[model samples]
Target: MSRSTLRRALRAGALCLTATTAAAVIPAAADAKVGVSTKRLNIQTGSRVTVKGHVDAPGVAKLQVQRRGRWVTLDRDRTNRSGRFVLRKRIRGAMSSRARLRLSTGETRLLGRMNVYRSALASWYGPGLFGNKLGCGGTLQAGSVGVANKSLPCGTKVTFRHNGRVLRVPVIDRGPYVGGREYDLTAATAHKLGFSGHGPIQVTK
Candidate 1:
């Protein structure tokens, strides 16, 4: 081949190599400044909670939650055209929760805390229906704190503390068999609280 043609080919090859190297380096330099931001976190037991926030990076690859010493991946999403990310997750039990964001360049982390409490409203069921289906999909027991409510969704378990005693009961039927009261405690629950013959006791739902 002619020397001019050979020299021209060499120049084109060098230009291509330099362009590829610059392309790779530019993204890495941009990623060094990317990071995540946490906005809000509120967690509860037997309920759903939302986590919201944003990410600042040239490009984000993954988002997740770290709880109980484990990691749960949040859905992969992009920041707005303005470069921000928002995400959420549901907490189920008592544990430490944290947020993690992965960017093409690096990673960002945030921390949060939560507490789980027993259901606030627990009552009792009556006799004769001891073997019947409790609203919570379980068999009813007289001594158990099984409540009957027309409004509360069936299968919901209510929890309450009485005179230093704590009780967790499933909701079942619906009424205060005799009086126009809100709940009807079984003979057993009444006996446990020293109020077998008394009326509705104060309950927390």
Candidate 2:
């Protein structure tokens, strides 16, 4: 081959080698070890949830929440000298699901659930409703503990807070069917939270 042709071929070979070596050196994303301030974060609407955590390595941390079965990044923070970060998100609507943190290396660390609650009026029921078939397939007995909502998916666990008492129950039946009321708490659930006739209650979706 001519000198120029030989030189071009040599350069092409060198470029191909470099690309292959670079590809070989690339590392796969790994699962990161991280610690957050809380495992289960509970907040009411108009309030914000603050997440403070430390990763094993210094990198960008993203706070992810689930929406429509997909993970959506809502906030992010850069690691400090100690690999610690703080992320915040204000609650606008009711949301309760598993949250996670993703690092810059694509490493993901499962944090915990973030429950956002909204205010609603709820009343207790049970007396005449016992032995009724629940919408989710079960019997609503006097001792059965659950909540009733007009639209929440069946078997959806709900966290309720009232009078400084908190209770977690599943959505087992249809709603109170009363206007201006959003929840119909079972007698057992209401009793557990010290709830009576039903006034203001906080519920997480």
Candidate 1, run of 10 with poorest lDDT: 113-122
- The parts of candidate 2 lying over 4 Å away from their true place are 1-33, 38-40, 133-138
Across 1-205, the per-residue lDDT of candidate 2 in tens digits comes to 8999999999999999999999999997666678886443688877887788888788899989877899999789999998899888887888887888888988787766788888889999999978989888889899999998888898888889887887889999998888999899999999999999968888886
Evaluated at residue 92, the lDDT of candidate 1 is: 57
- lDDT by residue (1-205, candidate 1, tens digit) is 9999999999999999999998987853333444444444333455444444554444654555765578667556566766765555555553334555555555655444332333333344466777876544666665565667666776665553456554556566665445455565555655666555444454544
Clashing pairs in 1: 54-85, 55-85, 79-84, 120-204, 120-205, 121-204, 121-205, 135-155, 136-155
Clash pairs of candidate 2?
A: none
TM-scores vs. true structure, each candidate: 0.36, 0.73
